[model samples]
Target: MNEDELFEALKATLLKEDREALQRLQDILDQPEKLSQKMSPVLEERLATFKQAFPKEYKGIIEKIISEKLANSKEELLEAIYPIMGKLIKKYTALQFQLLQERIDQKLKFGIWHRIKTGFRSFFFGVKEDEMILNELMSSTIDNIFIIQKHSGLLIASTNNNPAHQDDLLAGMMTAIKSFAEDAFDKNGAELEVITYDNYQLLLESYYSYYFVVAVNGNISSHQSAVIHEKMNNFSAKYLSRDKVKSGQFSQALSINLKSYFFTNPIA
Candidate 1:
């Protein structure tokens, strides 16, 4: 055996072992279940080790890679993240709305303590107690009053301080807004009570045949709201008969009566 022959013989032996190993690997690869069984333990071990060392070993690398990708493909990254961002924004907006509603509820909750405190302050200070209480609790004024036909959205009667008021247009608009709000919220027989804008508010009191829409200019306390509601009930009971209202028999007499009633006892 010379040098070349000896090298060739060693190469052949190695080649045979390599072929046998390759054949065994190919066989394992062909059978998916067996391959999974063999690979699972090794993969699990590797993953465990990676998880253990990830913070120390790969954290900086991952951050750098992400930073680089973001820097290089800013628009692409934003596009990918846009949907998630929108969903997050919508969720945040909804949460904010709920928080606002809760805050309003808190402000509106006039407990016994509040009444007592207000009463005591009024008694001691010798100020106009009723006015002071109204100021402290809620300084509201009725800007416009409307008695609207429910299904027809007809203007039964209305009164407002504004001389430039468009009664028919305002009535239609108010009815549309009320309808939209009720349908959108789907409150299951609950009426849309308050519609608020910058420094203005509309308080709605719904009834069977007709509804009362009172536009107010400030915060209305619970007591004040109840008083107004009671007044409305009285008005309805005394003047607006359901049959008459439904039959479109709301005459000028009834309108004049409504105007007189509200004007005589104005809500401040």
Candidate 2:
């Protein structure tokens, strides 16, 4: 049997034992040690059940808890709760893995990442694809689209659809970021960096001391920002495919950070 089966079996047994333990505790309030005495048998039985159910996976899980070499905090009261908590964690993890497995299977079959990239490309190019992606993303409650590149400036894309800084401001931001990117790439060859911009202003002209602004816009969702990254990655990938020596290091770094956000909140 798989881990899920083992978890379900263990959970059922634990639930029953929990109920019984509570009943016994209610009956023997005067003799609290009676509850402690009864817990050992239940723990042993559950472990035995797990061993029989998933013999291979059981040993590691059991050993980790046993090897912790720490005293149970409630040993004098409800002794089983400590072990039960551990078992519950394992059971919950098993269920989560099962669900994620199913999600991956379905998504992988349909080339979900590829499709997302395609959708993102449309958004960046300001075409039909862009409308679909932007519309869907704006509908969501996500705000603040942050796009960052290590050694480069930050691109703040938003749904405000404002062209306030369409020329000079954008030029200054790009120049500042490009300078940083060139310097870093020249030094490290391949390096990773992360930066954030808490606020900004209308004047495109400013002394960029610590970091520069690459692109600026109004309110945007986390989802739209991710789509932008995905498109940029796809764009870079295609370029790199043609010429292996292309400097896609910045794109790759941004994509890595974007990936963290995507995984945390997909379809958002």
lDDT of 2 at 268: 32
Candidate 2 lDDT (Cα, 0 to 1): 0.43
TM-score of each: 0.50, 0.21
Candidate 1 to truth, TM: 0.50
| Ten-residue region with minimum lDDT total, candidate 1 | 78-87
Q: Model 1: runs farther than 4 Å from truth?
A: 1-125, 128-137, 161-163
**Cα deviation of 38, candidate 1, in Å:** 99
| lDDT per residue (tens digit) for residues 1-268 in model 2 | 9999999989888799787997877877657687668777998999798878885867788777765644443322222232333344445545664664566456545877756785577767766643444454345332333332222343322222345734334434654655666576787532222233543212121111111122323433433333433433332333222112123123444434444543455543
Q: In candidate 2, which residue pairs get closer than 3 Å at backbone N, Cα or C atoms, i.e. clash?
A: 122-130, 123-130
Q: Alpha-carbon error at 132 in model 1, in Å?
A: 3.2
* Candidate 1 residue pairs in backbone clash: none
Candidate 2 lDDT trough over 10 residues, lowest sum: 203-212
Query: How many pairs of residues collide in each model?
Result: 0, 2
